[model samples]
Target: MSNQATPWSSAMPEAQFQLMHDILAAPSPIGLEAAMTEGVLRPHFERIAPDGWGVKTFKGHAGIVLDTHPGRDDLFTVMVIGHADKIRMQVRSIGSDGKVWINSDSFLPTTLLGHEVSIFSEAPEAPGEYRRLDGGTVEALGAIHFADPKLRAGEKGVRKEQLYVELQIHGSDKKKQVEALGIRPGDSIIMNRPIRHGFSPDTFYGAYLDNGLGCFVAAEAARLVAEAEGARNIRMLFAAATYEEIGRFGSRVLVGEMRPDAIIGVDVNHDYVAAPGIGEKRMAPVEMGKGFTMSVGAIVSEQLNRRIETVAKDKGIPMQRDVVGADTGTDGMAGVLGNVDCAATSVGMPIRNMHTISESGCTRDVLACTHAVAETLLAMDAEESQTGALHEAFCSQHPRLDQARPMGHQGLPESD
Candidate 1:
């Protein structure tokens, strides 16, 4: 709201930017997010968490939660979640010609063509051990000359079923050769693209920005909240969830288990203004480098949203209102789907080309989200210190239609 630039609008710290790059570089495709959860998120959390803070891991998955003021029944609990899973392809089968058939999960066939990928295959003999197979490219109808006239002319679209990984292993027993390398039918495959700065300032482009950006934002916010000085009457749960690309199962599980008083799901959103082929369908004019995004519909809690907006406005942090109709399409719905009675909402940074190999986002937006979330949590703590009943305060602050005053007509007075 101020003409002058806010502190968060500027470039983030060099170490923080490096942490973002590290998070995006680590591969954590759906059903296999341990590489991200244990390798990147856990270490980051441990490094920043205060002495009293603790970490909680789920039973059978890589989902993790960092807790502040744990096991405190007298304090209000807020769970901020960011899922760690990235959309990925799975090995469906292998051909004798060395072509590896794959199932494209949440990706269009056209965007995947010629993109390099790394296949993460678990060893058959050593079930827990894994091998990374590089130097493979996703392909379909190899070479423009081999395609049908209709397909080449754009009359037909290439289907995911027809896509395969061309490993270029030449042998009569190509299937046997591939099997010998421990590439099984269920191995996960992910893009090998690393995060890189875009042409513009504070912009970055890369693969798996969908949820890694979310996790990064959440981690940074947790660090900020932990460092803030306050009475700290609220219990903060910063969760890095898994399996969100599939169905948001990991966040739902965490929500059900923790059953917090409120939840804020952090994830990436589309920059609809710059997105291609979104003809005639009305969408929020969200853009990258503008600010972070806040959900305005679905299961979003009005009181919680107002709290976040107040913090952003007071801090001069920019944010855009995102309209999500039936569902937020993020982990914000975890509490709802888990049947937990709690206030919930989503916050995100807008990016271009979501779900593609070359997704783009702005560091300014990421920092804005981080600041907004951290400031909001600190604000809640301050309010709780004064009110002594944080949960009741939020629950009682919903907008009331009866208290609304009619707006005065500015047009010429109606003639009687």
Candidate 2:
């Protein structure tokens, strides 16, 4: 292994930024991630992992999965999964008064009060089948348009009916136009927010940074692993999944299908600004720009965690460890729980304002995570993995007699 970091490390910032922009620009709510994945992510993986490496798209019950596994069987596969969907709203009903009622999906409706939104519609042009429309915006409603003085105090919850999506017309005439556009009651609504860069080029803020950064990291890691020659013992699958905001629907499907020996979930970790309750036992800082955060807890594999930590240290990648007392609330945990038992752990990108507009993070931190993931894959030994054997040095010095048993044996015999 080279002592220096690969040139791929420097390329990650630009890659991360570009992917983040594309994903944020697409109107992909939880159940409406098809356009984003099929339009943006699939093409990216095809371009990056070329040479007949076609991107695989799998449709599921409530979501979609884009598979980017380079066909290599030199070793067991490590699946890198990321959720592509963000929390948004769904069209409920179009009122006769020209305003459309929307049901917020998994997020506060007040956060979307004044923001612009795009309602995806499939409207066909002349002599053509229905095509996707340019999308519309949020109507001037909610607390902003409250005519009653008592209701303008912002003390009450924004009811689903209080918020409205504007189709740009009024009354029955507007309803007819919206129907002509092919937008229905079940159509998705996306926040119309643009990604913004901070004072430094490496830092930026935008909506849906929760898992956008994760998709970027997984994409870059897949590209690096596919392009590198020394990773003969490492197989990788990059899964950009959907419907993560509400549940792990896509990830559960991915685990059952891929059944990889190990699954690494790349997603956002709540920074202090986003989740002040998260703290290390030693009071170690887990702030933005610090580095990648690895979840350590019940669902995480001890062997995988140890190997990843060793790889990150050897590669000089900055990383932080955080404890998750129960579930990590990530796709990796979903895989561990739903699929056959295997190695599972999650690496989180520190993000602020998660699930809200203006969620942000540092590109440098993303790069660190991308590098750590690639290095860890390269460091895994297929022999140890397939044999299901831990290193002698890694074994506990004082193995508990009660917990020790022969392979395939459930309990000690009465003779013993």
Candidate 3:
């Protein structure tokens, strides 16, 4: 951690970026592995299985589970859900002839090339930078193409359907464009921020930290937990769930597996910024550069919150507090609804630009969450052991213990 942000902080690792780019490139209109890979016919095979991990699939779902704690295998099953799906990359119109005409929809075009449009709609936030696309988020039913009086095709004229949607990454040019960039549709388009490894990058950039950074912290922490002494037989799952952005589909399937008694979800929180309708209440401005923020509410059990707080305090980890009157719309939501009465909660890092590619994050924020979660897992040994003891005690108290004699008694008609 240097005073200056390190390259790692801003730079995406080859593997991370490749995996990210690949997944982001998928035609993941909604949790796309493959329409062909869905239930019924496909001979679905497990993709990634490590030693000591169980592999299973039911319906159109695939999952992995690790059972530690020997016989008390049923003690608690926790799930870590991270979205792996998103909206379909589509184009509504193509720009052309000094000005590319656009179908009145901004949503579709913006999703496609607006970010990569290589053109401008209006004055940019700063000089030389083009403003966000027109219609903001509206979908472009079609586009107006221009046969630049220069180069290859020699200016071919076409209609909306043939021209407009044809250039989109997920619409028409989806396959070709994605292949050109080695990307695909249904693949979640990550905010493509250049990760830097260092310090003092931003004082604020909160909320929408969501699961991306959360997943990273979990991954690093899981690695440490796995190799630590007295290694917490915690059987941690660093699930990088897909499709949360679309509809929380990843969380849906994951919750079915973990059913953890409680969970500490890692996401983002609103920064100390202001905007209409997004007041302090809806988007509490938890200060950035301070540390991690913890969510509190019925959804987040007091005991669990306090326990995490206690861990933070003891470890000197940085943290803040937030009130939740409604669902946080995170993997924690799924965790709360799962089989076990899980205490759902979240830890956040500072993130700016929310859903935009211009999103920024603090290394300190990510590190703080990692420390908090790692410590929480480390601190759970005693709690889990205590829970195991209580369970054993309960099981030993079977009321009809003496009611049924040995099976031999029933088998032999009482010789006496």
Per-prediction TM-score: 0.96, 0.80, 0.58
**For model 1, where is the 10-residue window of minimal lDDT?**
1-10
* Candidate 2 vs 3: which has more lDDT: 2
Backbone clash count for every predicted candidate, in the order shown: 0, 1, 48
Off by over 4 Å in 2: 1-16, 50-54, 59-74, 123-136, 139-154, 170-174, 273-284, 381-416
The lDDT per prediction is 0.89, 0.69, 0.47
Candidate 2 lDDT, 1-416, residue by residue in tens: 22355532343445557776886676667766765677777777777774534466664532333343345434466788888787877778877666777887765666676667777654444432334444455543533565555447755555655667765675457677666666667666777676877775567887887776777778778677767642444456778777677777778777777777778899998676335565533444677877788988868877778888998888778788876878888887766667565678999788777777778887767878888897787666444455544333234322356887668757977894
lDDT of 3 by residue, 126-146 (tens): 433322222222223332343
lDDT score, candidate 2: 0.69
Q: Pick the winner on lDDT between candidates 1 and 2.
A: 1
Off by over 4 Å in 3: 1-30, 33-72, 86-88, 91-114, 117-210, 230-235, 274-283, 386-416
Model 2 is weakest, by summed lDDT over 10 consecutive residues, at 390-399
